[model samples]
Target: MRLFPQSLRWRLSAVIAVVSVLVAVALSLLVRTEFSRMQLADARRVQDERIQLVVRDYGLSGDATLGAELDSTSIPAELRAAVKGGKRATYLERDATGAWIWAAAETNGKVLSLKTSYADRDRALDRLDEVLTIGSAGVLVLGSLLGIVLGSRLSRRLRKAASAARKVAEGDQETRVGATIGTRPRDETTELAQAVDAMAAALRARLIAEQRVTADIAHELRTPVTGLVTAAELLPPSRPAELVRDRVGVLRRLVEDILEVARLDTAAERADPVELELGEFVRRVASMNPDAEVRVTGEQQARTDPRRLERVLTNLLINAERHGAPPVEVEVDGLTVRVRDHGPGFPDELLREGPSRFRTASSDRGGGHGLGLTIASAQARVLDADLRLANAPDGGALVTLELPDRP
Candidate 1:
């Protein structure tokens, strides 16, 4: 059995219902007990008055005993014993017919009993029961409804904060929750939302400052890097000169990757969506990378930024060739593209932590600025696509890209 509701609204309503039930039961018992006590006191008073009347009658008639008049009354056994002993006694009890009987006897052998069927009292009790039953039902309905409304109101605020946090985590550093979830009444959840908004704002400022610094450094180094390349080309043909050129090229590529990452971080690259045959475009990208054997299957056409798609595919192919074995499979079915390589698959950190700039999936197997997959991922987001990395069960690395809104 499902013991609790996953939704907060139902849980709150359940709590209200339990409390209402307990309170209603307690109230009903207290009212019934008090009413019974009052009724019993009234019944005993009736019997006392009757006993007095019997004593008066016997004294006025000058009779020696009042047994004849007492025999017709419903005096209790205890009260009769007291009368025989020349003393007064009283008793209250219920009889076999469910009626309450109260009796009193006097010293002069006079006795009287009062029988109350408890009809009026019982009828009042029944009416009270009816009122309690109806009132309890009404309380339950209203309490649960109020709880649901309150829970929903609370849930909405939490959801708004949670949604904005997710957007921030997904690289939209500009997202903030404070505007929507204001700190009214200053509750704990409201305080938490304010904290989240502050954190997002701080992170956004830090990232913007970092990206600007990187872009500026890249721009500054371009002149020196170009000079080094010219000087290396002018050197005489030799092993050391070739090494100089090779190292310079690597430095140049690193600078370019850094600049590209900075641009992607700042949303500097805008997408130009165009209608293209996705299968053919991927096939062409595969042709550019001869290191991996590319196989294309299934045709699909979509409207998307072709240049960004090309960049994502090229990085995926390069990564597969550098870190994985041969036989890369590129398949496009509908709007989904799959790129698989025969290799040890993606590292655990890459799978769990996602792609990070300057953090290669495998340091020993490949060499780069470690921005290849990071760039691919950023471009995918820019194109409003999804790029996922995983290992094939058959022992290979798999990269899948999903595009939407087909033409």
Candidate 2:
């Protein structure tokens, strides 16, 4: 067990408990000091009155023997000087026997002294200290206990809200933190939970509206784009005709990507897995492109949706050709495909935030619409596969695809 816990719950509880104990102990000490001071003040007042009476008697009778009433050794030198000058003096001091007293007097040649032992007052203070010690300990224990319990409860609610936030970030747009947070004495944390839920709901609605717009736009463009492609095909073979055909092809691919993304957004893809030799299958796809070098380490058999998987490889290879240098390396190792190219590696943003449709890397890639890798990622999701992009250590870009043994 950790002497100091690293968890937020324990840290907060410790802070509350420490503050509670310190404040209670400080207040208790202040009360005891004031109580003792008031008791001592009362004793000194009574002693002063008796000393005045003694001095008055000496002034009227003029008796020199009245000085003998007080012990000479107990009389402090500073008090004696004050009394000799006809000024009344009072002091609280411990004598040779280590006993406390309130001494008061006035003198005009013969000292009019009065002394009272504070042994009873000292005993009272000792008893008061014992009682205060017990009371302060109880307050510290009780206050600290209450602080820890409350801290634990509050921390748990905060944790629930944090977990829900993580799920939302990971693409579960429907995630929401419960308003109640399963705690007692409704507090600020419950309000925070409600706020988190509201934010998530708003985000889900906005995303849905965005996907609907994308799907509608892609659907609307299909007929006109098809007609344009047909008109360009009928034209005589020339530079202008080729340009129109290429531009139309880019637009057609972009539209298809948008439509696919809209479908994936609505969770509409279904997997139809068929057993195949993954290594041979990867070689067959790589052979379609003459520039790429396919290296088959060993055959890895798996059950996966071939059509979706083919789309993933097609998009990835096209991206490699457009952005990366020639002699592209494709390695198939037991259900894993590592595609590396000699070029400036992927942009930092592309690695951190996964592929965004129509967002290009910092490096130039001809004039790509940037939908190739985005579509590949979406298709990989449909196949329940992992698609990762990274910058290889040896001055190149790397894309790794890993498929499960069974879909």
Candidate 3:
């Protein structure tokens, strides 16, 4: 009763098959009806011709021998009855006196009998019907099988694309849809897979950028803040209030550095570079820490943001004093500054972390948030300088800042 199947391929095949069957059935019926009519007409013509021939033969004998010739022939008994009963085989005879007579006789006993030769035509029609039925059934079965094969291949490709997409959604950026060589997908599923890969790539880049920014911000804020807190808690009550003012000044500088780093991270503020004497700048910074001897050995003039660049150098100097053994050495090599201190070198682990926030060596003596190196690194980046930290072979931490030489 239900002719169509659920699968698309099967349903299409079924529809084609059903149509073929109906067409075959209709043609067979039409052919059978026409054949039957033609056969019946032929039988009638043959029966009429035989009856006429027999009657002519009987008349030529000049005798009214009705049942005599009928009994002597091989004509069936039923056909003989039809001839005698006058349903068929009626003959008209005319005499020389212009009188006409119609006579009917039975060659045998039955009525309306047809010869058995027509049975062959019936058998032929039955065979034709059988062939049509079998051919149509075979075609339907073959078509259905082909449809299933094609549908399964398409489904497999779709499943592969779906699996790849799910892996990407779960943060696996390396996953890719497996495509056969030179076989491009031409459907919506392929497009979806492409879009998913793009999204994963974008997310990976953004996450890395955010991490770098966070590390830079934290490292920049740590040093000055630690100094300010220490100075505040240790200031003597009997000393002139001017000493307290100096401690407050340190705190203000720390707050300014934090604000500046925040603005730089957001791209809300940009650095403005100007030409300045590099030697005078380093010498002025060294004057700030009178207790420590700061050696400057560079004479290169450079164009850079004076305030920001100065802050970068100041951070490096303070870090050296806090962590290094003694006497910080600042040497200028071409357009680069190398700050070396006689101290225990950085650990291997710190070197691998690159520019990270709150990175402190376990051997460090001071108690403060580890943001000095991170902030200095960020400032160097903003100024388009390369800052590298490594351990000197003999024994010391080496910090290098390379800037572009002014024309």
Of the candidates shown, which would achieve the greatest lDDT relative to the real structure? 2
Best-to-worst TM-score order:
1, 2, 3
Clashing pairs in 1: none
lDDT scores of the candidates, listed in order: 0.78, 0.79, 0.63
* TM-score of every model versus the real structure: 0.88, 0.82, 0.42
Model 2, span 240-337: residue lDDT tens: 99999999987887788888888888867888999998888888998887988998887778889999999999888888888988778999988999
The Cα RMSD of model 1 versus the native structure comes to 3.2
Question: In model 3, which regions exceed 4 Å deviation?
Answer: 1-257, 291-298
lDDT of 1 by residue, 1-407 (tens): 88779877678778887888788878878887887788767766766666566666666874423332444445566657765655544566556776555554553444443344555666777898888888888887888888888888888888888888888787765567776677685788788888888888887889889989999999898889989999999999999999999999988888888888888998767788999988888878899877555444667678999888999999899888888888878878878998888888888898999989877666545665679999999999888899999999998899999997842
For candidate 2, the C-alpha RMSD (Å) to the true structure equals 4.1
Q: Estimate the overall C-alpha local distance difference test score of candidate 1.
A: 0.78
Model 2: lowest-lDDT 10 consecutive positions: 62-71
Candidate 3 structure quality by residue, lDDT tens digits, 1-407: 77655655556555656666677667767877887677656655655655555555555763333333434354444445556654565222234433221223443352322222345555666787787678767766765666566556566666677777677654455677644211465666566666656776787678658756754664665666667667776766656656775767666665565555555555334568898877677778766655445455657778888787788888878777788767677776556777877778666776787645445665763544456777788778778788899988887788898886531
- Give the range of the ten consecutive residues with the poorest summed lDDT in model 1: 64-73
